[model samples]
Target chain A: MKRGFNFSPGPGTLPLEVLEQAAEEMLDWCGTGMGVMEMSHRGKAFMSILNQAQDDLRELLMVPDNYKILFMQGGAVAENAIIPMNLLGYCAETPPIADYIVTGFWSDKSQKEARRYCNVNIAASSEGRHFTHLPRQEEWKLSQDPAYIHICTNETIHGVEYFWEPDLPGVGLPEVPLVADVSSHILSRPMDVSKFGVMYGGAQKNIGPSGMTFVIVREDLLDRALPICPSVFTWKTVAENNSMYNTPPTYAIYIAGLVFEWLKRNGGLKAMEKQNVAKAQLLYGYLDSSNFYCTFVEKDCRSRMNVPFFLHDDALNDKFFAGAESYGLLQLNGHSSVGGVRASIYNAMPLAGVQALVDYLRDFERIHG
Target chain B: MKRGFNFSPGPGTLPLEVLEQAAEEMLDWCGTGMGVMEMSHRGKAFMSILNQAQDDLRELLMVPDNYKILFMQGGAVAENAIIPMNLLGYCAETPPIADYIVTGFWSDKSQKEARRYCNVNIAASSEGRHFTHLPRQEEWKLSQDPAYIHICTNETIHGVEYFWEPDLPGVGLPEVPLVADVSSHILSRPMDVSKFGVMYGGAQKNIGPSGMTFVIVREDLLDRALPICPSVFTWKTVAENNSMYNTPPTYAIYIAGLVFEWLKRNGGLKAMEKQNVAKAQLLYGYLDSSNFYCTFVEKDCRSRMNVPFFLHDDALNDKFFAGAESYGLLQLNGHSSVGGVRASIYNAMPLAGVQALVDYLRDFERIHG
Candidate 1:
């Protein structure tokens, strides 16, 4: 079956081959006489699936031996609270302080949720600039001693991204761990795992499905969970059980494993990065060329995975979405908080899909202008 | 393709029809260009899927109007912690005491988990009896003005079940609410949702897949969450957001909705209960008449869903399992904690599957007796 381009931001488009492979294996996975969803998590069949997924992911990211990859549930939203619950124990002092750099909607939400458990210090925020750019590293206020520094590498809603990792040494706080929410752009580009203390994300964006969350954490960071932390969400507990502390979303993990395999077969993260850059450029270049369309994010910090843009005539918003949908483009409607169109071109979105979307954008501008 | 019988405790077997339907709609759902997994959680497509699932579940259980159906992530094991976090707020006293009736393995896990948030009282325990029976109501030591009472109506490991709800009046704790973890047997029989303050379970058994959990919470119980409760796990937030507090297990929920629809089409809970009784009786009756096999749980409390039995000759355990597999009976090996064979016949298991197992058992005994 022919499929159209999907731009839903999350639970986004998967590779056609991945979807076909999943459908073909829906009833019997590799002659196991059982669907992937039906196998016991502790059984050999599922254990292999989970092990291969974790191993492939580790290899793909070049994750260090000291880091444990945990497949957990509750997405990035729940991890906001879970992060504080797990990390507060590592603080040497009472009322442990954690620093957060708020870039856009996701980082802001992360800081707000963290307040429930500890002393959350917002050291820097791009909100003053309407979240159009990342806070400059030199300007960030570093806490004297913090349990961790938090950042959202890619803001899905505001279309802002950090191209460089925050260097704590530059800010005179070299010992603090840096935690990043890399949900929207995790697999879209290659990442240096050793530079960050922890990286986590929901699987819906560049990964596979909506229900699973992956937490890649350094070994030293695993033993610091607070007494109140739910065992299932505790990184230490999850890592000890090899992410099988609970069921670990058997089918979602299987699908994610399939996605990881697909990524490897297509030349790993380097290839994905190359194709992703091209897709983003095709759409952004066209938007920049037309006066009728504009992207708000700064050129230096624009997200390659999510492009939020606006039409010059606000009156044409409904017509723009309708026209795009008719041409087989989908979910271009921007987030409610951000009033514009957002074309989320993740790793799964091909160059041709972006070209089709760019063609529609140009056609729309010509007729509307 | 012909499929073999799968008896996995869970992440268990699903109806063949559900798997087929899912594959058929893998690319497009209900004429929507996007698959269920790809649709935005806030969009009309996924919302319709979520709403229909909740509505169908409510209809199947005859849940009262005051009960709110919440679709959340982090399966039953996570719900063990989430329940206390959400319910402890209803306590009138400091440190809020909750009573737990420990029937078997699952109930023991529940009480141990609840201790993280509240003071726990063991109101009744069948542990002294090796979890082979439910504690009689008259023997229960009721806690005065407790926050709530907890129970696991069906013990998946011990192969025990409560045929009747614990009448708070009979137990001399009439005002307190009852919370149940009905994970393995939720839809196998009709339930009185209004009788319990909350009913929750992971969806791997009877429902659909892993990663999704459903909570049927009473309306009046919504406002009592502690300040430390994670926003996503708090019942009030989940109910207010209509379970869209996070992305939710969209694909898991979709498949569960299909199971609910299948249940409704197959004469609903009444028919299911009747068939379940027949299946249990056939196996239990054969075991009682045969010297080769024996069940451990008390007859009155033996579960219709999970039937755990042992061979008379302990040496033949491995041979019995091998013989059963040759006849297409799978996952009959018992949980390691309970060393014997266990056949878990959830709602998805048809009468024919159980009959085939019974036939295999008789044939094996005839050959080896």
Candidate 2:
């Protein structure tokens, strides 16, 4: 009854080592008779766990001293509203203008939610191209004095990702801090923490589990939370309390800490990036070569993590999905809006899972084609 | 080394059976190649788990079909604000009157968050009494028509509880739906589901874990979410999606399901109540009879779940806690707001744990009193 590859964009797979370590310590954490889940967030055991996780994630991401990492909840979706509410607080004179670069589903969500809290400017979009490609930096429509330039570095749905970090240094958007919804690709590889003023993602995908989110923001931005922001969600309040302004997702943080340790043990982010590249290449190469399969995203922007593909013959979709499941390759079904197949190769996914999936893909095409 | 009894209000203790089952399922879930932690919420395996958990909880609680059970994140703190946002939609045409009865820290938190969205009336308050009892219903300043009358049925901090369901029939509040934040005492005993129009609890207490929240809302109130409410937190949206609109906390829900089954196997909520009563009685009896220890709450309103007590001689408090820790009774430190000791006896905390505390208390008093 072994489970198949879980291709959920998030609340997705976690490393077996991380889960194993957590299970072993479930009843008694660090000789403290109580598990991490049972401990008070203010207690020494949980404090140690929380601090270590924050520090390790910082070291791994090479976060600059000026940034504050917050462990909050409600995922990227809630942050859509929270980000604007907090970021646009400086719009004291009137509603602040925020610039958005629409890449796919997530950016669309961010843009819509931001509209609730500010006057949003769509500085750029790939919507004209049906979101199958990323618009280059040169194409973005600039807005003056926008509160922030928001982007979804990785769109989990459309499978289009930004492999190169945007350069805002000389661009008109330089003064406006870049805010990225990096939900699907935060820790898949190393990040330039200082490149963006704020980076946030739900933990379900690449971090650890579903109940927590990782937010890294420049320390100076902490004080600007709008008066309307919930105190618990306020960055200044959370930072001042060391991320314990409220009872955080203790177990999730513990598991995420275990993942950070595992990541360190398995070679740092560069090594992870290399492995991710290898995994993505193996799957994409097979799909591109097969006439029976078609990947919608352009070659250059294909995500190194989530890969959504469609069979040339859409009629065999269910049979394709059923066959894949029997082969122990699961959740290949694509998003409802785009009915086909999607394979999310998050960090927890091993190279073997991708090979198995690729192998299954080839075999399925051979028979179904 | 066994852990000490964790007495921190929430992110609290869980049933041993639940933790053990979770531990066993860490590597693989019922032969699925993945652990529950690794499964996508959309994956069939995790969905099956989710469905079963929802079904079992529905059965255990006998929740009406008209009521929707939502599994959400952000704990009770987030729900404090989210609740008013979603519920206020129905009250939008009106002046947005909502009644809140503040008993202790948690209720105070709920009231403060609700004020952000609605015209909250402090229907009753025990804060002036130093949180030693539930505010008498007769003294309540009832509004003729409120969007909802809110109550923190069980205060996690002051250890004061309403021994009986609030009777609002005499007041105009009868037609006004009763909304209760049952965060600390949701399933410790059988609850009259029909009494509350909405009941919500943070999972860290008696349910599963910290990151998850269990919300039960009557169906009619479901569709009234404000247009700006985040879909993930909207009761209507969650019920329609069966708690899977977003990637749910699959592992947490699975663990909660296991706890539900464990409760059923051990005689359901009725049996749980009996055990809790006996356990609380044992500890409170010792405290009542001892010259050196005292309980602040009135006997009629004292909680059978959380017992906050103190040494008559404050100087010996540290020695009392240290000695209790030596006996493996942990988390005895009281909340900082109240400088004393507190003991929480959730469903997962067996009578044995309480007995152990009583034994330790007697020994400590014998030497130090």
All candidates: DockQ: 0.77, 0.64
Choose the strongest candidate by TM-score: 1
What is the Å distance of residue A308 in model 2 from its true position?
Answer: 1.4
lDDT of 1: 0.90
Candidate 2 lDDT by residue in tens digits, A1-369:
465677777777788778778889999987888888888888988999999999999988999999999999888887888887677866433658888999898899889878877888999999888899988888888676788889999999899999888888868455567899998998889888788999998888888888788889998787677776777788888889988888898888999999999999989799899999999999999998999999879999999988999888989988888887788886677877777888999888889999998888888877877
**What does candidate 1's lDDT look like per residue over B148-237, in tens digits?**
889999999899999988777666666678899999999999988867999999999999999999899999988877888899999999
Candidate 1 collision pairs? none
**Candidate 2 CA-lDDT value:** 0.84
Model 2 chain A TM-score equals: 0.97
lDDT of 2 at B104: 91
Quote each prediction's TM-score: 0.99, 0.96
- Candidate 1 lDDT over A271-300, as tens digits, reads 999998888888889999889988889999
- Global lDDT of each candidate: 0.90, 0.84
Alpha-carbon interface RMSD for all candidates, in angstroms: 1.1, 2.0
